[model samples]
Target: MVAAALNGGGGQAGEALLTLALPKGRLAEEAAAALRAGGLDVPGEEGEQELVRLLPGSAFGRDLRLLWVRPADVPAYVREGAADAGVTGKDALAEEPQGVLERLDLGFGRCRMVVAVRRAEAERWPARLAGEAGGLSVATKYPRLARRYFLERHGLRPRVLELRGSVEVAATVGMAAAIVDLVQTGATLRANGLVAVEEVLPVSARWIVNPVSLRWKRPLLGELERRLAALAAGEVAAR
Candidate 1:
């Protein structure tokens, strides 16, 4: 089910344009800024409930179609060929990497995935984990990554509970012994009486391309890469 509203393209000619899946919300502003910084003109009329839009070649130096989707859905769109490329979180890529080639780190939306627990149980985390036997349960939005982390890093077999939101409250309410979640600041965790116990993965937005697109549209994709790479380098250097 592709839940996207397309905007900006005209006629059969638009089908030949390079398409990109751009995440909506906070990352939308950042993605546009990055594209503009790369010297591409981003122009489009905002329409109510539009998820996909096009920028005419006359404005952007190339006929470009943009698919606006929820951040988490970006990878799926690219993988499924709904888009030739996309901007999404590294964590999302990790969750679903098949059929996608990670092209560049766009250098925005930085955060970390971590294992957190109620503050009162911070010191006992290690011992508790060790003593839990085969019944250890962990709550997270990323069950795949969380289960892998515990098994590979700690050698613990855990029952991973996947939740759509509010993973922080898992431990307090006894839904699980701990939670693996993304954190930009510890403010929310602390407010919920939780503290990070282990670092899982460092995350940031990434530019990804469909493998088939890479082969079929090499020149255009390369040019896009070159422009975006320059901006990424500048960001790295300024940091």
Candidate 2:
């Protein structure tokens, strides 16, 4: 599905161009800045909310297409070939059920996908369970990854239910035993009386290309990839 968007050479002939999927939110600005820092200048355009709209390749050296999308929709944009490549949070990748290829960590949107329960009920988690037969129920937007992680690592089956915007409400509604969610500051969890039980995974903004596009659009995407990687590496040094 992702093949169609990356087709055709640029004006220079044989200049394979690529379409990248980007999330529209606070993450968008950071993603663009990273691209610009990498030397891929993102040209400003007309009629757009800071939230949506992708930047088309500039007449300048920049030739990649950007499609700004909602947070959850990024995967569909990539998997369906709507965009040849995309930039999104690790949380999205883990949630989507597909054998998609994951490349490069942009490093700016660093966070963690973790398991949590009400602070008062945190002690309910047994250090050791009696057997693998007993199942655990978990809540998350990433039902797929949450279930797989528990099954593969802990040898227990997880009953995972997806929760969206009002995640804290899941706990109060008794819809889940615990939640697997992204934690940036840990304040949200605490405000909801939840404590981190464990981290299912660590995440950041990732540069992903359609497996086929990664090869076909290598020359094009590489232009941006090279720049973002350099900037990400320096974050630690500057601190």
Candidate with the greatest lDDT versus the true structure: 1
Report the lDDT tens digits of candidate 2 across residue range 1-239.
12333343232112344566777875777776776676665643321253333334541354556667876788777776656677788888877837457777777788888888777767766443222144566778787888788887777777777767667668656666678888989999888888888888988888776666666667666766776678878863564
Per-residue lDDT tens digits of candidate 1, residues 61-168?
666667788878998888877788888988887776687899999888888988998888899977898877568899988878887889899898799998998898
Off by over 4 Å in 2: 1-16, 43-63, 97-99, 127-135
> How far does residue 102 in candidate 2 sit from its true spot (Å)?
2.0
Q: How far is candidate 1 from the true structure (C-alpha RMSD, Å)?
A: 4.0
Q: By TM-score, how accurate is candidate 1? A: 0.88
- Clashing residue pairs found in predicted model 1: 5-52, 7-52
Backbone clashes for every candidate come to: 2, 2
Which ten-residue region of model 1 has the weakest summed lDDT?
Answer: 1-10
| Candidate 1 segments whose C-alpha is farther than 4 A from its true place | 1-15, 43-49, 58-60
